[model samples]
Target: MKISAIHLYAIHLPLHVPFVVSYHSYDYMPSVIVKVETDEGIVGYGEAVADEHVTGESWEGVYQILKNTLAPVVMGKNPMEIEKLHDHMNKTIYGAPTAKAAIDIACFDIMGKKLQQPVYQLIGGRYHDEFPITHVLSIAEPEEMAVEAAAMVEQGYCSFKMKVGTNVSLDVKRIQAVRSKVGEEIAIRVDVNQGWKNSATALTALKQLQDCNLDWVEQPVVADDIDGMVEIKAKSVFPLMIDEGLKGPREMLEIIQKRAADKVNIKLMKCGGIYPAVKLAHQAELAGLECQIGSMVESSIGSAAGFHVAFSKKAITSVELTGPLKFSKDVGNLHYDVPFIRLTDKPGLGVDVNDEMMRELTVFHESVYLKEENV
Candidate 1:
């Protein structure tokens, strides 16, 4: 089947609470939803979450790329030729991995539907039916964070990722309080989001945090500071996982060559989509580094794509597909059971967009395709 049309929706899904990291804070998720229609009447859905600080992409930019550049390239092409489409986009457009990711996921969804197989099986088959999820604690006061951590633990979440690196001492206190409240058995991780200005400060804070038994510390220094990560890794007791520094396979290779990090956080938007993400995970695995499949503040559509990649790969040691859990509402009906996100045997992503919910959240809409006469 060939492509018929592509639709774009710019949506703002309100969050249950303001999500704060070291560098950015948001009360709602700005996302671009992509729907690809084939001539055979199969439709595929995908999402691209806009995070200027992370992926350097915005919802408006993603929408425009999908309309002007991507639509023309794939108008009469086969959705199953994902690689060729990716190459065409790479050569045609300069930047906008998130935009490319949206189309990539939609194409994968179409391919899965055509085969009547789940995306996980199409990618690598299911290694584990369910994987443990890490609950993220947004930046807040020490006491407030502690309360939230305890509440999440009570809700059946065993792993937690705390947004730290704003203030070293206060962050220490935050971790301490959460640890005290949740007891010692729960797993806790920290993401600095490049908050520490230098390796010395990061090392000092990590040294102070040695007693917390953190699962790992992520992106302690600036994104470009590979040397800082190497130094910090040598000095700190905990494993260091790089997030912002990783773009794709080349960056992964550089990190591995430098021996800068023990682990890496792989996000679909950051790496483009599942195709590149799977390659990055394989590279990390070969280099003896662990990987955590993470996500942007996205809707269930983007989260489902991340979930499929995580479920298909054996190298993914941790998962953070908690977007649906953190959002006030999602555009799709998804199953969430605390630490696990269940996937179905249905074709494609196995999730459908909630039409009413999309109508409620949509802020902008656009569609692009060649007319029958033009084609």
Candidate 2:
């Protein structure tokens, strides 16, 4: 079926509680929602983690890219040809990967729907019937973070992703405190969010976390500091995982060749969508690096899509699709839970947008404008 139309919306979902990180802390999540339509009457939806505070893209930037760049290339093209569609969009704007990723994922959703197969099948067969995932705890006081970790553990989440870029020494102390509370059995991972002062400073802090027996440390230094990544991996006792450093297979290869990291944390929003993730995972395998799929704490719309991808990608070492927990409410009526998050066993992404749920949560709205002729 040929593509017909595209609808874009900016949805702002208020957080259940404030979420703090190394960059800008927030009380709400702003996401750009994309709906790509086909002539055969199928609709595929996708969401982007639109954080001007986190990355360079803002809500306005999302509007421009979707309308001015991505829309024209795919308007009449076949959705089945994701690679060709991706190539066309790439030609429109040289090396604008993020914009391409947003559309690329929506197309994957469309292909999954057309085949009546879940996205997982499209990438690879299921590795686990039920996926064991971790709960990513945001930055807070050592005591507060520990209490939350305790509660998550009680709920059957054995792994915890701790946000450490707030205060280096304090970050170390916080992990030590959480480790003490959770015991040695519960797996603990640290995400500095690139909060390290420099390669030297990151190494100093990593040594402390290694002593604490961290499972992995994520983005400890600036993303471009591949040399620093190599240095840390050589010296760090704990395995290193690259979150910000990887854009796709190219970056994955770079990290692997440099021995920059031993593990990779792939996010749907960060890499644009799930297709590139599958390709990236293959490259990770060749390099003997482990893979984990995580999210940017999006609404259920985004999280469910990620769940489908994580379930489908066999190479994923662990899963982190926790946007529903952070949100006061999820967008789609569906919510995935427990040892494995089960998206409805329906075809495609297995999610039906719940209008009422969206109506209640969306506090931001904007119009897509065609500033140029082809947009």
Candidate 3:
């Protein structure tokens, strides 16, 4: 089928509670939604996170790129030629990677619907039916975090991912407090979110944390500091998980060759989408480096997509698609695997977005972006 028209808009889905991380606090997720209309009148939806801090992309910028640059190139082209369309869009701007990413995912979803197969089929053909325990806890005091940790254990969450990066000493104290309370049976992991003080401070913290049995420490330094990460990985006994520093499989390869990071975190937003995510997972498997499939505070739509990626590979060690729990209400009717994250058997990502809920809950809204079809 050929493309008919493209519509780009912003959907502001409110979170049930404020999502606090090391760098920012978010009470609602402001995502740029791309709805592509094909000549057959089939509509496919995709979401791109408007993360100014992580991707340097805003909702307006992502929406404009999808409407003006990407929409024009894809029109009239065969909808099945996703790669050619991806290349055409990529050539327009080497800069707007994240914006390109949102549009790319929508196109793939459209293609999947046309084929009557799930997106996972095109993304390495579903390896596991379900993923392991994926959970996100609030950033509380050492005592409070420990209490939450104990509660999570009771709830059947095996892996506990903590948000750190406040300071070297305090971050250490927080991990230790959880370890003391949980008594080391539960797997403890920390994500600093690019809050590293320096190589020296990271090394100091690593030396003290060797006994904490951390699953991995994420983005101990900035995304740009590849050499610093390599040096830190060399001295530390625990694995160094790279998040912000990576772009895709190619970047992951570079880090592996340089030993810059012992592991890598693959979030759909950062890697563009499942097409590249599967490629990265298979490549990581070939290289023997573990992969961590995480999230960027995505809604059920984005979280379900991440779950499919996690279930696609055995190389994935820990899963973190906990965006649904952070929200007061899930805007979609998707069911994830209990105690872990898993999408239903329903088809094509297997989630239903609630229209009425979105109508009243939408905290932000924007006009439908349209481009000249003949342009």
Candidate 4:
């Protein structure tokens, strides 16, 4: 069936606590939710949580692109033609992956519902029913960070991703305290968010961190610094994972060719949703590199999308869909057992959206419908 209408909601969902990375601090998540309705009355949900520093998209920009640019191209088309629509959208605009992600995810949802299967099954089938989720510690004082890590560990979280990029010495101290508090069994990964500034600084920090026994280090240098990544990878003791540096398959190929990183972090928003995310994961798999399905701090809609991709690929060794845990309130429900997330066999995303919560959280709204002539 053809798509009949598309609705957009711009929301500012308050974070449970301030989340600070290197480039910015997030007090709340400003995101766009997309609802795609078809002539057969099936509806699909999607989310877009963009960071101007990361994905180069703001909430307003994503909302505008969804309403003015993407909706027009997909309004009367078949939602099942997701890949073809992706081609059309790429031709229509450039570098709005976050915007395209909203539509791409919605279409995937529609496709799954129509086929009476879950998204993971439609993609590559599920490898596991549940996956471990990583708890991220925002940049904080050494003692405070250690306390938070201990608390999550006590609650059954076995994996942790620490945000450290403010200062080299302080960052080192923070990681050490957490490692000391949690002991050795818990896995710890560090994400600098390109806070180290340059290759030399990153090399120096890596030297100091060699003793921490980190599981991996992510984005030590800037996003565009491929040469710097190669240099740091050559010297750093910890395995390096590229995050902001990777946007799509082209960048993935470059990273593989240059031997820039040991792993790549795939976020649905950065790679234009599951359609391309699956391809990127396959590319990394072929190159003998591991993958981590990271997040954009989205609600259940986006987190479920990432989860599906992570479950579908063997190359994706790490999963970090913890956005639903950080939000004070969410529009959809994702069952979380502290460190692990489970999925149901329900069609599409297997998420139950709360209409009332969605309405309460929305700050802006719009609906686009196909014209009669187009139909």
Candidate 2 lDDT over residue span 44-111, tens digit each: 87787765533467766776788777887678788888778877876787644555666777787788
**Best-matching candidate per lDDT:** 4
Can you write out model 1's per-residue Cα lDDT over 107-153, one digit (the tens) per residue?
88898999999999988899877887788999999999999988888
In terms of TM-score, which candidate is stronger, 3 or 4? 4
Q: Write the per-residue lDDT of candidate 3 for residues 1-375, one digit (tens) a residue.
A: 767666555667678767777888887877766666677766666777767767677867877777767777777666677677767777877656667666666666677677777777767777776766656655667888889888888888787888888778888888999889887667878888888657787888889888889888888887888888988988988888988888776788788789787788987788777666777888888888898887877777777777777776889877788777777765676565568555555566666667676666554454332246442
Residue pairs of candidate 2 with colliding backbone atoms: 120-312
Residue 106 in model 1: lDDT: 91
TM-score for each model: 0.97, 0.93, 0.92, 0.99
For candidate 4, lDDT tens digit of each residue in 1-375? 999999999998889999898888889999999999999999999999988988789889889999999999888888898789999999999989999999999998998999999999998999876788889999999999999999998899998999999889999999999999999999999999999988999988888877788999999888999889999988878899999999998899899999999999999999899999999999999999999999889999999988888888888888898889999999999878767887888899888889999999999899999899987
Better candidate number, 2 or 4, judged by TM-score: 4
- Ranked candidates, highest TM-score first: 4, 1, 2, 3
Q: Which ranges in model 1 have alpha carbons more than 4 Å from their true place?
A: none
RMSD of 1: 1.2
